[model samples]
Target: MKIFLLTEAGKNIGSGHITRCIALSQAFIEKGLYPYFVINGDNSVKDLFKDKKYIIFNWLEERKRLFNLIKTSDIVIIDSYLADNTLYKGISENAKLCVYIDDNKRIDYPKGILVNGGIYSLKLKYPKKRNLIYLLGFQYTILRKEFWYVGKKKVKKNIKDVMITFGGADTKNITTKVLRLLTNEFPNFNKKVVIGKWFRNFNLIKKQKDERTEFIEWADANKMKELMMKSDIVVSAGGQALFEFAQVGLPVIIIAANDKNQLKNINEWKKTGFIEYAGLWKDKNLENSLLNKINFVNNYNTRLQMSYNGKRILKKNGSLNVVSKILQELTNKE
Candidate 1:
């Protein structure tokens, strides 16, 4: 079967959607299916699909062409916020099977399979429609293979190392602000910052580097897991990193990123006692607020409990589960 992933990635859009698509694509590959990406993204996004089969379409200028190409797919799965109801309807009418990987029920979706992989997905009220299969909550969280088999992290008593990441595109440069404050105030703690391709403040971040600070760029899933495993605590933008950290059983402080969907996901996950919620980056007192949360979660008991609770809530079999269901549906069609 040919599975086509309809998604976008780049500096403006961020990488969460494409990242999850890649994870799902890998699942499809393991089932002996070839996956193709239909992308509307920047050069950085092109680099990401260098090893895969993909085609570029300018969604703005080539709507007819894009829809025409999508109509030929066996299974078309969309994971983009930019796609409107018109696009969704077109895909639903054309494809043999249409699946939407949604975080929030923001659109008036047509008849199709809806998958919400967020921790708070169960609480969402999706519109009832015929021929719609809802795969909600943790059972469908599509994490990469590297994050799947991670051994739970061992949090140290005194917090020796802290890993800071703000998603694929830290557009507002939150990492720089947090890193500066962290390096100046808490020089004793070993700091590791994961810089993505879209980070604009790399030069500025480089200036803040000290013996205790290290920067990691273009981290594949394995490198990401390694860094998370080594750290005692993590300060991250509330994106896919939150779920991965939760799976690894690392105590986390979530600073809201630019994505509205991610902000919602983070706020919901914060209620579970697994993550400490720092205010959004736009807040005037974000640095101080984040520092306070960091200090608050530094205790051995707090870290240990957070780790324990996170592990208890997250399941690592989501990719396999989702794949099995999709394959089953496809098999029945025959």
Candidate 2:
């Protein structure tokens, strides 16, 4: 079967969409199917596709080339924030089996499968239609293969290590701000800061790096899982990484960094008792909110409960579940 995964990522666009798509692609590879990635992104994304089959181009602008490439594809999965109705329609008409990975029902998607693996996806109330096959909620959450079967996290009594990640781009430079805050307020705690490839504010972050701060640059999924396992808690952006944290049972303080739409997911995860919502990045009181939450999470009982809630809420087999469904659908179509 010819499978093509369409997505975009860059310094400006962030890497959430591409990251999740990579998870899904890994699922396909597990099933002995190699999927080609058609990305409209920058060079920073190349590191993610080391051994994978992919081509980089501006699919949004060169629609003709994209359509030509996917015209004969048996399955086409598109995850993007920039694709419009017409573009979706074109892919739907061309591919034998079309899958639209959604977050907020961004558009009236063309006929095919609609996969919204967000924790709050069902709450969005996607319209029921005969043409659409709905794969909603956390059961379909696309986690990286490394996170698919992680053992339970060991929550420490005292918060010695803290991991901070703000997506691949850290477009709003939240990592630097959070690192600075931690360096000043919690000097004793070891800080594992993930520095993305597109981090333009690395100089600022480097300046704030103290004896307790460890800078991790462009960590792969396995390395990320390792860092999460070692950390007592994580301060992260509201993105695909939340599900991974949940899978590993890491207590999280979530900040809505670049995307306001993340507020819904952040609020939902907060309700689960696993994550503390630290408000949006643009908020004047965000730093205060984060500090307060960090102090609250310092209690051993609170961290334990957060860890328990997170492990209970998410299973480590979400990516496999999604793959099973997609393959089943394909067989049915045949």
Candidate 3:
């Protein structure tokens, strides 16, 4: 079966969409199917697709080329914030199976599968339509293969290590701000700061590193999972990473890094008791609010409960479940 995964990533656009697409692609590969990536991104995204099939071009602009490439595909999965109704309709019409990966109801998607793996997807109340196959809620949350089968996490009694990770772009530069706050407030705690590929403040962040601070740069999924496992607690941007943190059962404090979707997801995930919602990154008192949450989660019991809630909500088989359902749908159609 020919499979094509469509998404976008860049310094300004962020890499969350591509990250989840890669997870789904890994699921396809495990089924002995190699998926082709059609990305609307810059050169920075090339490293993420190493040893994989991909073609980088602005599919939004070059619709003809994109249609030409995926016209004969058995399956086409599109995960994007920029794609419009027209673009979606084109892909839905062309492919034998069209899957739209959604975070928020960005548009009234055309016929095919609508996959919203967000924790609060069901709450959105998508209308029941015969043409649409809805794969909603945390059971379908798309996460990297590394996080698929996480073992039980050992939550430490004392919060010694704290991890700080914004998304790949860190467009609002929340990492450095949070790092500086951590350094000043939690002097004794070891800080693991994840620096993304498109971090413009890399030099500034590097200068802030001290004996208690370590920088993890451009880490792959395995390395990311390892760090999350080792850390006592996490301060992260409200993005796809939160799902990964939940998979590992880590207590997290989230900063909605200037994205509406992140803000919405953070609020929903907050209700689950797994994450503490620090105000948006642009808020005037974000630093103070984050510090207060950090102190609150520092308590051993609080962290333990958060960890428990996280693991309880996510079962770590989301990717496989999504793939299985999609394939079943394809079979039924056949």
Candidate 4:
């Protein structure tokens, strides 16, 4: 069966969603199913689909062309919030539409599936919507293959080399702020700052580099996963990294970078205990609070408990499973 997968990625949003989509697309390839992508533009994530041709439609004209293309494909799965109800309505009438969501924004989408693979299990109560499947929880969290390979580590006191990663682009520059505050507050600890490719404060981050602080300019998901495995403690923004950190059994300090739907997801996940909040930019004393999280999660006893808890809560290699199930359901409908 043919599928049109719509997702957006760039230096702006860190390409996590699109990257996960690639993992899902890989499952389609294994099953000999066709998965065509519709990307906002060419990106690092798009490289995953070397064999697939993705259609490029500007946001304004996207609605018109996407529906026309959906009519031809057996299933339409969008991993973006950019696609609205009008697009869903047209696709719902003509083809099976499955939406991937992490944002808490409510929608009147019908005749499709709403899928969220966040760390915390999700639940959406729509008003008697028909044929709607809300695939909630972390068992369905979509992540790249590298993160699933759990690694060995030694978190002996200050031996825990903390690797703190915000998203690819710190639009708010939280990483820089966190690092600055951490060094002064927790002089006993060592750190590895994953300065994302698009981080604006390169000069500031580079200047702060020392023996205790190892600054990484950029590392692909594979390398980043290895770094995360090596670290005993992690303090990062709550995005795709939150799930990856959890999957690796790293105790994390989850800070919300953006103030919208992603923020809502972070809030929900905070209650689960696997991830604890470090507060966003608004809090008066966020830096000290973050230091506390580092100290708390870094403990041998706490870290051991978190590792055991992570194994119980998260599914192993969920991308292939989720993609396969969605594809199977769509083909069965045909």
lDDT (0-100) at residue 77 of candidate 3?
Answer: 97
Candidate 3 residue-wise lDDT, 193-248, digit = tens: 98888889898787767789998888889999999999999998777888888889
Q: Which residue pairs in model 2 clash with each other?
A: none
Give lDDT per model, in order. Answer: 0.83, 0.88, 0.88, 0.69
Query: Candidate 3's error at 31, in angstroms?
Result: 1.3
What does candidate 1's lDDT look like per residue over 7-101, in tens digits? Answer: 88888877888899999988887778878898888666787887899987766457788767767767888898888888788778878888899
**Winning candidate number (lDDT):** 3
Report RMSD (Å) for each prediction in the order shown. 1.6, 1.2, 1.2, 2.9
Comparison by lDDT, 2 against 3, better one: 3
Estimate the overall C-alpha local distance difference test score of candidate 2: 0.88
Indicate whether candidate 3 or candidate 4 has the larger lDDT.
3
Give the lDDT of residue 18 in candidate 3: 87
TM-score of 1: 0.95
> Candidate order by lDDT, highest to lowest?
3, 2, 1, 4
lDDT of 3 at 267: 73
